[model samples]
Target: RDEGLHPAIRIALRAITDFAIPFQKSSKLYWRYFLVPEAEFTEEAIPQITAPVIEVKKAKNEVPEIKEELQIIKTMPNEPREKIEMVISEPKKEEMLTPAAKEPLIKNPAIEKKEILPEQILDKKALKKEAKKPKPKPKKQKSDKKEEGFFNKVKERLASKSIDITDIIGIKKDELILKVKKEKKEELLIAYNKRKITEGDIIEAHKKAKEADLPYSILNLSGIPKKIQDLIEALKDISSIEKL
Candidate 1:
């Protein structure tokens, strides 16, 4: 006999104790009894059931085929073709007939052509006019002439004062004029002869000459000494002094 325990209560106990049971031992007991069948549950086998035999039906038969007869054709021999010949006719020439009356031949009028000469082709009068014209002469320039005159005047003035003017030719006029003003005329002439005249010497001389109401031209003649008289007489012929 079994206890009157509810299925839910038994399931709850098994759920709680499931961890305590070994899985391998539970599987061996389940396959041994629950899955295997006993000899009392076996039934006897019935006699073998037989099936009816079947027959295969045959299809309708087709008609018999006949072989076709072939006919052989023979080709006729070809005849040779003939070429046709063409005849060409030559053209006939017609003779020219003469006129009943012949006319007299007339000549054309002659043309008169003139030839032109080279002299006749050009304008002779124009050539002659150009050849007859006179050429212009160049005018003389005077600035250099004036400068030469100024230098000549300076030379004459210096020479009158017994100054050696030849050696002073290349000296600038302005510088020479300045030298004639500062120093005594004799002293300045000496310095000028020695090529040592100062600008102050010339300025003082120019001032003295101005104060005395005399021209620089007069001052140029102020320093003549008796010693240079013979020298002046000897240079007279060869000097431009004559021209001055």
Candidate 2:
């Protein structure tokens, strides 16, 4: 019955303040609770991916098994061959002994021990090189300035010049700022150029470019047809233009 008062707002004000919600509880319960209905996945589908096995085919000629047949055999005659006997001559006991064996071998030791290392050949050149292996010298830095005089002098010289020094001083990580010393748009009238391409392709491109809201170039109205190579001064200047 009261004027200018909503029933819900009036009922809220009449609530007990002593038993009010704590400041911490207000923040936690401020958000409305949402009850998400059980998801209906019956209409949804999951794709099944199957792996395909790839078979590699190799040519039989490429196999290296044929290289193992290193030996070649030839057929011999069926007839039995006669064997020849080598002549043997008996040399005297003194003559039979070699120059080295004559002295040492003649005087047989009480214990005939087998020679473990018969001969050892030492290379003097290799031994000398290995023995003289040089120690590595400590690496020295190219520059270790006592003061910043060199850098200060360079900066002072740059400051003296009228040219901007900030252009050169830059971190490589930053993107390069493209600066054109001289920039101007130039227009050329080529109605009289006799060697340029003037064809239906130019008209088609112009229409398409206009519809698509783009800029297009077309060389047209050449009374006499001429090849590009003829007009170019050098062979290298006549680069192959890529076709779109």
Candidate 3:
């Protein structure tokens, strides 16, 4: 039948069929789409990700480590060429000088001159003569009498009032006046008369009141030492109060 067609038309049709693409038998356009497989939803396999490796280079200016001991050597030319040896020893403590050795080393010129005097260089007979001479006693000073008289009066008052002032020795007049003023003297004397106060009790009372920082004064104590009052004011936690 192709022999009935023109030669050019035959050639054209052969070329068109050769270049055309053939569709599947189950294509949607052919009404057989159910026979075709549904479009697939697939998960692709993932390769593990890793960080790249990096190499560090050492600095060229780095100093090399030393592995040797350091030492010092000294030699003298004029000295004998003896075998030199190294010795390691602990330091030794210097010994104290004896009295016999130290006596000659005294640096005082007066003492040296005194040692050369004829009176200092005594014989056994002269020593015996000096030993036989009567020894003189140290004279008592006048201040000792004044101290004794003051203590005697204090003792008399302590005995009459039955107050223990044993711990109150060596108290000067100024100290006594500070503890017991002239105005407070009558009050202290009255307290003593009632057997409620002792000689050194007032000072102890003041110390306690100052330390505790109580609202009320102890035994009506007043006129606290300026040094103690300043210290109390300097404290952060404790509140300052009127001097007492």
Output the lDDT of residue 175, model 3: 25
Q: Any runs in candidate 1 off by more than 4 Å, and if so which?
A: 1-141, 169-244
Best by TM-score: 3
Give the per-residue Cα lDDT of candidate 1 at 89. Answer: 13
Q: How much lDDT does each candidate structure score?
A: 0.35, 0.31, 0.34
Q: Return the TM-score for each candidate structure.
A: 0.17, 0.15, 0.18
lDDT of 2 by residue, 83-178 (tens): 110001111245324454323322225435666553332466567788899978764443323123434433454346432233221111211111
C-alpha RMSD between model 2 and the true structure: 47.2
RMSD for all candidates, in order, please.
53.8, 47.2, 46.1
Local lDDT at 17 for model 1:
33
lDDT tens readout by residue for model 3, 77-125 = 4433221121111111221133332233224354334446666666766
Return the number of clashes found in candidate 1: 15
